[model samples]
Target: MGSFLGFSALFYFLLAINMGNLMVSFSQEGLCSAPPILTSADSSDQPRYWKVTNPTLSPAHLQDLPGFTRSVYKRDHALISPESHMFGPLPYWTNTLGAYLITPAMGSHFVMYLAKMQENSKSGIPPRDVERFIFVVHGAVLLTDISGVTHSLNVDSYAYLPPNSTHSLNCDTSSTLIVIEKRYNYLESHIPDLIVSSTDKQPLVVTPGEGYEYRDLLSASLAHDFNIYIMDYKPGQFLNVKEVHYNQHGVLILEGQGIYRLGDSWYPVQAGDAIWMAPFVPQWYAALGTSRTRYLLYKDGNRNPL
Candidate 1:
């Protein structure tokens, strides 16, 4: 019994030491804190999502760190894990599920947040001042638009709400959602209509390039200043050339792993990671993992030179 107890104690001690080392490694990789307690929203038995409470640092202040640039945010470190409190006032959020604020790391045209909502939670903008999109990453949500039309959105769901449109979002179960808002910079004479669709339902269109396919969620013609696309790249695929564009992009990696080239350096990216590129920055991507790599990308377009 004494020998067994000794071994057990030693085993736990080693485990603790290994956990400490792992945390140190993550910290070195620029995570603001320890590994977060995350719950999969797909699981039926477990809680659908995790809530971040009383963060110590603000989301905007995270940009002040040395590694992040004005035009690129590699991850939502502080907002996802909720170790720091850098979020400013959030007048639009009122729910039991907490919200993690994300300051626009790439550009000033949008306000973004990751929200965890509980069953029966009532939240949303009524007659918004800006155009916005609500994307359901996990679980489901019921969205009601201005005309009292309701739509049920499941995972991979995308909905665009036009400016001055009244909308209400409610979920019957716990869910995770990303809300992005931007003021429309009119490039044409007419206002764009609301677009709603699931990425799974959208047909993949082969692009002119090799090893990639894209699905347009919000195209340039449908929106005033931006286009949203789901891009899929098979394993070992890569861009033909490093390219630069006058338009900027906001990208969120949804699945698999890859190396993203921005400017002169290449950075490793994976699921849940995000990137922001300024106008004319050289960029490229190559799939590195065994599985297919996919991401949701946003590019501002259709506007004259400011």
Candidate 2:
């Protein structure tokens, strides 16, 4: 009996010790849970902000970007052949258009052009079927729609068009216009070609040499799926409004000043500013600077609208 009792006491002591240890462990788990493991992946997912100290400097650690290649280097009027071991030849000035350092050789999903409107033309270029985003880089233009309603656009003004919308431009003064044409997909509604009258119309007169314009200097494809253009604007100009389809867009203000209306918010935009917009967001702009407002615009896809 004595031996059995001793054995039972030993078992109870062991059980109590184990129960106390379990309680301690449970309390510790509640009070001192292991900290979450920090990792590089966590940091990478966090938002990053970069401020421009020097606009001329290339962005750091940018080589990982898609289709990134070294820009062609030019010296005083001479094109230097790249070192054999390095990336191919740098871009030559003649190969560049407007402010773009390089343009895609073949077909681009989007095509950008810089054109000047003839002074005082009662009827400027009529609207066509293409999806167009126009930024009035300089001077003034009156945009008239099919209904004959006219909206005046000046420097820094922008306009976006949905497919098949009819519009026209009337240059009160010789004006510089930056035009962007985006290709649409087969699923999109068809945009008919622009129709214009062949007859001459009364042209507005302005000082010929006083009108000048420049476009986005750095046009590029980002992420192999989107086309990007940077537009610079002078103050007192306006950006037009249009509906967009199949594409979302963002604007990053790199320099100067402007006012941009995205949705119901009227945001005063200046250098180092950014505006994110989705499709069909009614947005427009007005330049507020004495000089120019410069910003980057990006869009996706290369196909034309159906």
Candidate 3:
């Protein structure tokens, strides 16, 4: 019994030392604090999808190469992950929150946040002057538009709030939302009214390839200055067509695994990865693995080049 106890004590001593070393390594990789508590529910025994991604466990690299031009904000166009407590509650969000503020250095024209809210919880109150486009990724929500009409926003449901308009977003169930916000560039034309719709109700417009599909959340019009949409690609190669254009984009990979080429680098991106693309930086994507890949995309629209 004495020998057994001694051996057990020695084993734990070694284990503690190893854990300390592991924690130090994580801190060196830019962790603001200790690693997340690993419970049996989220352990290796569980499937990868069930496990949460910790950026400290899998650090993202910087993409500011010296070869790129200095025209943009250093062009740090790279994959963003849920790092540390950076995925904390959003301001004005009551009850439960773990919204990832996924805005990259794409200038002041646009920003986005990915959130998973629970019942009774509410989305952050939008600034009165900011135009917002909210897309429901999963579950549903009750959005009371500025005119006081409550709309049931279910899966794939989206709402576009014009500038200076107010709305209330309360959960119908545990829901995931992609909120894209931008400053509306006003023109002499009439301002668009509130738009609320879902993807299933909209027609699928095939683009470029047979497997590629698109769902525009909002229509093209002079009254609107920005647009949001979803692009679905089946399992295959679709990265051959690299595009370099003047329109910057904020992208969220909604589902499936894929390789996304942004600027001069290629990143292995999966579901929930947020990406920022600067104007004229080459961008493309390819759906990999066995499932279909879909991404919520945003871009400035209906404005003439100055």
> What is candidate 2's lDDT per residue for 1-306, written digit by digit as tens?
999999999999999999898788777665444434444423434221111111221233442456553322221111111111122221221111232211233223355444545555543332343465666655677777667877777665666554456666666555655566554343434333322221012122233333313343222322123444555455776654344456656454556666676665566555434344555556677788475775656666554434
For 119-200, candidate 1 gives per-residue lDDT tens digits of: 7776757334578887877788888888999999987898998888888888778777766677777655668887888887
User: TM-score: which candidate is best?
Assistant: 3
The best candidate by lDDT is: 3
Question: Cα lDDT of all candidates, in order?
Answer: 0.67, 0.47, 0.71
lDDT of 2: 0.47
lDDT of 2 at 251: 54
lDDT per residue for candidate 3 within 1-306, as digits (tens), equals: 999999999999999999898798876755565444444543445432221222222222222333432112235464564332255677788654665444544443577876678778886666766788988766778999878999998877888988888788998467767788776778885687899888778788877644578887788888888777788888985755678877878887776677777777777776657777778888888899887888778888788868
- Candidate 1: segments with Cα more than 4 A from true spot: 1-90, 96-106, 126-128
Q: Provide the RMSD of all predictions against the true structure, rounded to 1 decimal.
A: 9.3, 21.5, 9.2
TM-score of each candidate structure, all chains considered together: 0.69, 0.34, 0.72
Q: Which rank order by TM-score, best down to worst?
A: 3, 1, 2
Model 2: weakest 10-residue lDDT segment is 76-85
